[model samples]
Target: MPRPRTVLLTGAAGGLGTLMRGLLPAYGYELRLLDVLPIPDEPAAITADLADKDALRAAVHGVDAVLHLAGISLEASFDKILRANIEGTYNLYEAARAEGVRRIVFASSNHAVGFTPRPMGTDPLIPVATPHRPDTFYGLSKAFGEDLAQFYWDKHGLETVSVRIGSCFAEPTSVRMLSVWMSPDDGARLFDAALTAERVGHTVVYGSSANTRLWWDLASARALGYEPRDDSEPYAEKLLAEQGELDPERPEHACLGGHFTTDPPIWPH
Candidate 1:
């Protein structure tokens, strides 16, 4: 089948979503924006909570594919995570299936495997087959999303690509981010690959630039035709000079998820 051209982009107002909004257009996609929060300068962007099933179905109608990015991004109380991340994702998948959307690109997080030990020295890169060891309610929700994607593909013929994204910022600010940072351009490239890849039943891939200090393997991502261009090494010197080298003794630096494992963030009520 030809690549899906009309896509429903959820979470249109968030940091990453906004970046995608600008870049995906360059790849010949007609994005239909949706989010609970209103997107500026977009009168057509749907502003509805994920809990609203009726609005979700309406938002997904006629879209060739869905890029599901709406959810509580940080560690939150279990209830919040359940509602926004867990149940909310379910609602979107249901809507997509009901609307006959061909595929979904799920924005999963590295925190889903937060407890996994980071590769040091010659240690092997973490594989996509790594078992889930979520360190927080937020991470748990992402893990749930991954499982849900698989279930949908198995039973409902809904294809999905669950991207375990690292820090996708314009620049690497901290030593930890240097290991996992995905540049804005590389992120766009990964998404484009995911959208166009063939025979993706329920693929799982790490999302990051070709960083020199990468902790996870990119083979799965590359299988989808993703070729990450940016590297965080240029910024490594400044970050290392300021923060010093990662000490294996430090709980935060010992894992791929960084401080998220050491101190899980709770959403402020």
Candidate 2:
């Protein structure tokens, strides 16, 4: 299929969403922003929860594709994760199907496989086929999203790219981030690739830059024509100097999920 010109950008007020809002327009995409939170300058944004079927349908209407980035981003209580991530993603897919939007770029997170052991000596790069080992309720919700995308593709013939994003920031902030940080420029490039790739039937790819210390494989993403332009190596010296070296014995450093692995899981009363 040809690249989509008009796309629905959910979670427009969120951090990554806000970044894409400023960048995607340069790629010739007309974005229809949606979020429960009001976008600062986008007065035309669809201000509604994803659970609102009517509003969601309206948001999906006439859009050629959807960039689903809405939902809980952190390790929130299970109830919150269920309501916002699980139910919200389902509602979005239903709306997309009903509105005849075939292509979607789901903003999945590395948390989906957060429990995977970090690479040790001679450990192979983490592949896209890695089994689910979610570290938290938030991570579990992302796993559900991936499966949801797969089901839509199998049953409804919808196309999706579930990007298991690592740390997407301007630069690496910690020693652990050196293996996972994705530059903002590369993030935009990957999303563009995911949106434009042909014949991607619910593909999943690790969303990180071509860092020297990268833990996950980028072959899947590369197959979609995603060529990341940055690396976290340059930031390594400063980060390591400030934060010191990673201690493999620590649970936070022993897994890809970092602090998420050791933090007490939150739950709703």
Candidate 3:
């Protein structure tokens, strides 16, 4: 299939969304921005919460595909996570179905399988088939989103690509990040590939750059035509010097989710 010309970018004012806003247009995508927060310079952006069905319907209307990046991006109370991420995502998909939108690029997360042990030494890279092992309420919400995407595809024929994103930042900031960080440029490339890939029926791919020290496999994403151009190896020297070697005994270092694995549960508070 040809690349979608008009794309609906939810959470358009968030961190990743902001980065994508400036970059996706360069790929020839006409973006219709939406967010609860006001977009700084984009006066035409639809400022509405994802829970608002009517607003969501309006946003989905006339768009060729949706980049579903909306939702709480970090660990939060279960109530908040339920409302913002879970219900919010369901609402978005329902709206898309109602509006007859066919394709979606879901912004899933590595946290969905955060409790899974990270590969050590020459151990094989973690594949996309890994089972769910959510480390936080935020992670659980993403897991639900992936299942929802699958359900939508199986039942309603909606095509989706659920990108289980690692740490996406301008630069790799820590030794641990060296294994997971995805450069902004590679992030755009991965998303573009997901948007343009033909006949994707609820595919899931880890969103990362071609880092030499990566802990996850990119074969699934590569199959979608993603060619990551950046690596975190160059930042290894500085980060390793600052943070030192990871202690295998540490619980945080034991899993793919990092600090999220040992962090206090957010919902009971």
Candidate 4:
């Protein structure tokens, strides 16, 4: 398929969405913004919950693809996770399918495989095909999103790229982040590649920069024309010095999802 010129960017008011808003336009995409919360500067951004089927269908209409960044990002109760991440993603897919939109870049998080062991010294990088061992309801929701993406592809002929993103921040702040951090610029590059790749057919790829301490493989991402230009190496010395290196014996450090694996937040009553 030709390059997608117009995209519906969900979660427009969230941190990653806000960062992407400043970045993706450089690649020539005209973004249609959507969020449950109000977008600060843009008057035209769609303001509605994902459960609003009519609004979701309308948001997807005329857009070439969707960058699905909406939903509750952190660990939440099963009820919240169901409404925001699981059902919300399902709603988005139905809307996209109903509108005849072809491609969607789903923001599947690393926490989806939060219990998988991290690569240690000379250990093979974690493969994209790792089995699901979700540590929290939030992670379980992401795993469900991947399945949802696959079902949409097989049953409805829609294409999706399930990006299992790591810590996408301006800089690495923790010892674990040194291994998982994806710079904002590299995040944009990966998303751009996902948007333009041909015959993706529900491809799942890990998202992060070329970090020296990377725990997972980026080969899948690279195969989609994603050439990451940044690395978390420069931040290594500072983070390591402050927090010290991760100990494999520690449960959190042993897994790819860090604290989400060993110390997930307790669900609220």
What tens-digit string does per-residue lDDT give for candidate 1 at 1-269? Answer: 46788999999899899999999999999999999999999999999999999999999999999988889988888888899999999999999999988899999999999999999889999999999998788999999999999999999999999999998888999998988999999999999999989989999999999999889999999999999999999998899989999999999988877888878666652
User: In model 4, which residue pairs have backbone atoms overlapping below 3 Å?
Assistant: none
Question: Cα RMSD (Å) per model?
Answer: 1.1, 1.8, 1.8, 1.5
Residue 29, model 1, lDDT: 94
Poorest stretch of ten by lDDT in candidate 2: 260-269
Total backbone collisions for each predicted model: 0, 0, 0, 0
Model 2, range 1-269, lDDT digits (tens) per residue? Answer: 78799999999998899889988988889999999988887899999998899999999999999999998888887788999999999999999999999899999988889989999888999999999999999999999999999999999999999999998888888999999999888999999999999999999999999999999999999999999999999998898889998899999999998898888345431
Estimate candidate 4's alpha-carbon lDDT, on a 0 to 1 scale.
0.93
User: What are the per-residue Cα lDDT tens digits for candidate 4 across 176-266?
Assistant: 9888899999999999999999999999999999988888999999999999989899988887788888888989888888898756765
How high is each candidate's TM-score? 0.98, 0.97, 0.97, 0.98
lDDT of 3 by residue, 4-65 (tens): 99999999998899999989999999999999999988999999998899999999999999
